[model samples]
Target: MKPAPASAPFAGPFALATLSAPDGPPFPALVTPDGRTVDLRTALGDPQLTTRHLLEDWPAVLPRLRSLAHDDTVERGTSAGLRVHAPVEPRQVFQSGANYRQHVIDLHVAHRAPGDDRPEDERRAEAAEIMDRRAREDLPYVFIGLPSALTGPYDEVVLPAWAEQPDWELELAAVIGRPAYRVGVAEALEHVAGYTIANDLTDRAGVFRRDMPQIGTDWLRGKNAPGFTPLGPWLVPAESVADPGALRLVLKLNGETMQDESTKDMIFDVARMVSYISRTARLLPGDLVLTGSPAGNGIHRGRLLRDGDVMDASITGLGTQRTRCVTEVTP
Candidate 1:
């Protein structure tokens, strides 16, 4: 495991994480605000406790976790050297696409066809108008993501040999705490357990089907590669985040800042996105709703991921994720 970055300590009063030694099985742990870790399995006296188990009964278990956070008698250790895994083992993942206002506009301007005479300003204005209408009238464009794609925040990502244009998309993930079906936007947030960081890595080359344009995106092939999603240093309880819409998201590539934006740019806020998903599908505990990525993707910036590159992604209140990239070795 890579050494923890010298960044600010988790801002939340307490958070949850999955951690282990280099050769041991992963175990659920509680992270104190000061950056110390307590083994939940041992501390809670539930040897089989997992982060998912807590989320399954989040309303009932949250108070206990709060008590544990303030208990000074429990043994605690620094998380600096331990192997940190994705905080929750989500059973289902829902992802929103093109939900950021500026991101969509930038994509529109960057992907203009060859010899198109429209000025950049005109194209941007047109896209912005479309996005404003989407915010008011259209439903979010959401898709499913496989759980097998998840990896730890500090783990290594093996870029597949076939992916020619691998890119980075940093996003805020909402962790569900309660079952929600056909819920309204006003009640959607009541089901959210917390917030975390996710880097939705994509292979631009495989996003669309050239031969079957009508069939549209091939997300399973383009985005579901193992370790494609580097999620969580920890989960900050929703109560700890004063305003999810105001938090900042920043992603740096090889020490150079690439994406810097705020959730305020989202066309649809968390409540709207969650409620929209619940209208058609039942959202259960431990499920993740990725709000969507902001602008500054490699496709827009003209610089994609390469072998030995490092990405440091973070959101306010939520912890940081540092993932190193390496090209896959084919035998």
Candidate 2:
């Protein structure tokens, strides 16, 4: 993929995007109802208008931002189409692992247990039991991701030459608005400022630690490659989404639909995942909770990402992303 043209008009479902104007610097821009771009920094008259600031003061900023979205005639730039940057420069990114029910089932079916020769139905039944136990215990598996891995939603992804099996995991990332610690599910949603799309690219072949068996998974080595996390075409405010757990996520690889599933299939919804994580870590404003991806990944289809593969991923009302896979030249 090539660099974005100087004038890629901001016209999409994104409520707000951290973007830079042509020949200008970067800032958070709000997309008005009439498809105009209002630099949040200028609109609010604050040079530091960023995702983190808006999120921390969302309660007071919401009304002001909402006002701008309705009145497009309030002196905005029509031709100031901006290019997207990463939505938020998060300090902490908590990513859920295996939070999608169907995705887990798909993985289990694809990699069956050896020698047991148990009936398929029996295996599925056991998996279901495990899921139930985990849910009931309020135990959700989550891991940390490096903020340095983030890139713009429309950026091209570079696959390391040594990575044999690269894959994509499209997920809905919840932007934390308020500081939360040990919050319960009932109030978890209160901390979310809005939502965005994230493509958690993975190097499938490096997911496990063969030499360090006791250590298990290695997300940092397999998932935290530069540009591995392509985030946001925009961030739709939390109020805009009627139900956080009722959205659909779709992904296409080279124009072929690879992932088509809904957030309804989550083993633990956004609220639960957020609340569960808060028990241990202090989630600050702008931190992201990437509620795991849905089914239909490259590994399950017996196909993996390669050079020149284009990924078009989108979530209901959040926005779409066009990520091209490129090969990084080995030194």
Candidate 3:
């Protein structure tokens, strides 16, 4: 055997910590704010480098950064501070549908509740009424989207002219760190390099059929637009998160909280999703899997993204990613 192709820079906890903007080559190595990108990758790869040695490399390379706390530097510098690129410019994007019970209930109510602005109490009562009446009657929906739609942090999500109601979704996306087929749940996290944030943009006009119920087409149309998958900030190496399933996820529109909840809200958690998704496709390093969004999306309110809208999405322990929207001639 040729040693299984060397497995792309697998490193220890301290090695993982050294990532900086513009660090790798061909593409500029990830750069640090105080100007040190060289040490991140080298430290990760060097067998002689320990956690303490890696810390020494930073202060020697960029003295100003030495004072910043490790957690602060990683957040303020790597995950939160770096000028990001998409998590992966892969060939495909996977979306999970009706993945949360609350999302399903929201859809049911949005489709059936009479169109009217009701008092907060009335809305609460109606929600309770709907919950009492709900039943499970659909498949576990999953869909595909093009990679061309992906844009990185600080990038503009260009709205298509054909888009009548573009919506924002705060989804947790995983960057596959290795290749595996029929991987067990116990081995799934090993395949994940880290997690990043994504906006699963939706084009609502293509989502529904006249007044008929929302179907896969609505979900697909709402998801597949150029510049739709705005991702990054940076990949917070998995070791940093105590439990991926427990992180709190939140999204804001121009600084106003829009979606706020925990990753614990998932109907299917991270381990199951990874094992399930990989059963069908052998996930390779750099391939991304978007773990699905929670309820509180704009489409539920008949509201959707418009020009000049700003979106801020974050997963606790994973740094926040932000983007601005602009209208572009739909090509």
Best by lDDT: 1
lDDT digits (tens) for residues 25-105 of candidate 2:
778878753456777887798997777788888889989888887764666774234577888888899999888888887
Candidate 1 collision pairs:
none
Arrange candidates by TM-score, highest first: which order?
Answer: 1, 2, 3
CA RMSD per model (angstroms)? 1.4, 2.9, 10.1
TM-score of 2: 0.92
Provide the overall lDDT of each model, using Cα atoms, as 2-decimal numbers: 0.91, 0.84, 0.62
- What is the Cα-based lDDT of residue 116 in candidate 2? 71
lDDT of 1 by residue, 69-162 (tens): 9999999987776888999998899999989999999888976755888999999999988888887785688999999999999899999999
> What C-alpha lDDT does candidate 1 achieve relative to the native structure?
0.91
- What is the lDDT for 246 in model 2? 90
After TM-score superposition, the amount by which residue 89's alpha carbon in candidate 2 deviates from its true location, in angstroms, is: 1.2
Worst 10 residues of 1 by lDDT: 1-10
Candidate 3: 10-residue stretch with minimal lDDT:
1-10
Deviation from truth (RMSD, Å), model 3 = 10.1
